[model samples]
Target: MDLRFDHLIHAVSDPERARHAFADRFGWHTVAGGEHPGFATYNALAYFGLPYIEWVGVRKPEVAAERPFGRDVLRVLRAGEGPMQFAVRTNDIVGMADRWSRAGLVHEGPIEASRVRPDGVTLRWRMLFPAQEPGKLLLPFVIEWPAPDEVRLADLRQSGLSPDPAAAPRLRAVHAVVGDLARLRRSMDAYFPGVLEPCESSEQGRGVRWTCGEVTVFVWEPAEGALRRVLDTVGERPFLAEFERTAGVRTRTAADAARRLEAAGAPVHGLWVVTSE
Candidate 1:
């Protein structure tokens, strides 16, 4: 599978605010706006290291395209909240998609040159959705960038991005909570094969301890309860607070972060962050 951190998603109401917040507070640099066709979004890029952070905002109806993942993005936009989605970069889009298809996983076709980053870098890949059932968090979507180095992080450094290694955001880690845990692990095993060797976790939660250069993903077991508890824990002081301030967006604290987040009026389904290097 050769999976690694591709990017983390942050949902915002105002793209401009999110951009400035990242640059001024966290020292992350953002490229200009680019179109996300199906998702109807105007997105920008910020880097932790190689894999950049994708800050996406729903575009106005006038210039926007179809809403890809149904209307989940629009919901997040209403809330003006934290991490929305995460992606894994595969070495081969076609081969991986073929394998997934053989395994009976349902996904979208490999759109030739589907999405382009704001830096003028074009990404070529296909996306796969979980088959039959949906919302099982083990594997959200699989993406493979075309080989021969179409878009390297180094190429975008000239766009007001810093070369200093220390400028990267201090990402502690990334965490996800899902209704199913064991099934999620099994699904990953079937798809990615031997790629789970370095992961570590427990019953209370499922976590993959990242190597020195990789980002960790903590997938917790979800229970039937008010979404507030889940949101609260993720937004608890140190992480969400610092994120809002450092990222320069709203929702910097527990007291009102939830309220501000929900202000977008989107159903708070799930949230996660891709920590910086």
Candidate 2:
């Protein structure tokens, strides 16, 4: 029952521009990830260790309308740019789904899907989406990659799809601002078990932090002021802000990252912050 953060999906209207921005700011270059057949969507991937960042966009709206998640991606793009959803990786997706279902969680599919890499290697996996509501973005969908870890990494590397471990920013934490912490915790407990630890937020509201792999997931209750405004704008989602450890100690703190990104003309919407720790 090993569950860990897999990747974060950043829905963008223009993949090339977004890719360039990320590369320019964080030295994280993205590679082609091939289109989703029958979904009218395509993606570029910036690999970072085991977890990665997926820059996804709708290629054809008319075709995308046929698929549920595809349509959701289109809608998110319509609003603005930034993280749309996050996923968790599991060794046993079927068993995990069964456990979640038994615990009274509404979800759809341990559905199988595959994508062909630019180098002609096909990658396949099964995914389970917990909860059908669009607002439930904070609830991570489960994914199980069928290929062996070595084979998958090798294939991706051969296709030049892997990130530069030395240059890429290491994800340290993921802050998820939710309207109801208790409700979200109840659902998360079934999948992550004892990972969640209670804590008090700076805003004086209840918060729980879960360590998933090298990344931490923070779920905080709704608060007043700036954070509350952000939650209202983004709705209940898994991503509020991401804290990353830079490749070098010279460039530490969110201000440093923000200054560089701003100089590069990249949008700084509080999505990622650089930390010394």
Give candidates' CA RMSD values in order. 7.6, 4.4
Candidate 2 matches the true fold with a TM-score of: 0.82
Cα lDDT tens digits for candidate 1, 12-54: 6666677776666445666665766765676666665565566
TM-score for each model: 0.67, 0.82
Clashes of each: 4, 0
> TM-score of the candidate numbered 1?
0.67
For residues 3-90, could you state the per-residue lDDT of candidate 2 as single tens digits?
7888888888776777777677666657778888756888887776777878888989998987856887887777777777788888
The C-alpha lDDT values of all candidates are 0.50, 0.68
User: Which candidate number has the best TM-score?
Assistant: 2
Which residue pairs does candidate 1 place in steric collision?
Answer: 21-247, 21-248, 78-264, 79-264
lDDT of model number 1: 0.50
Find the 10 residues in a row with the least total lDDT in model 1.
236-245
Clashes, model 1: 4
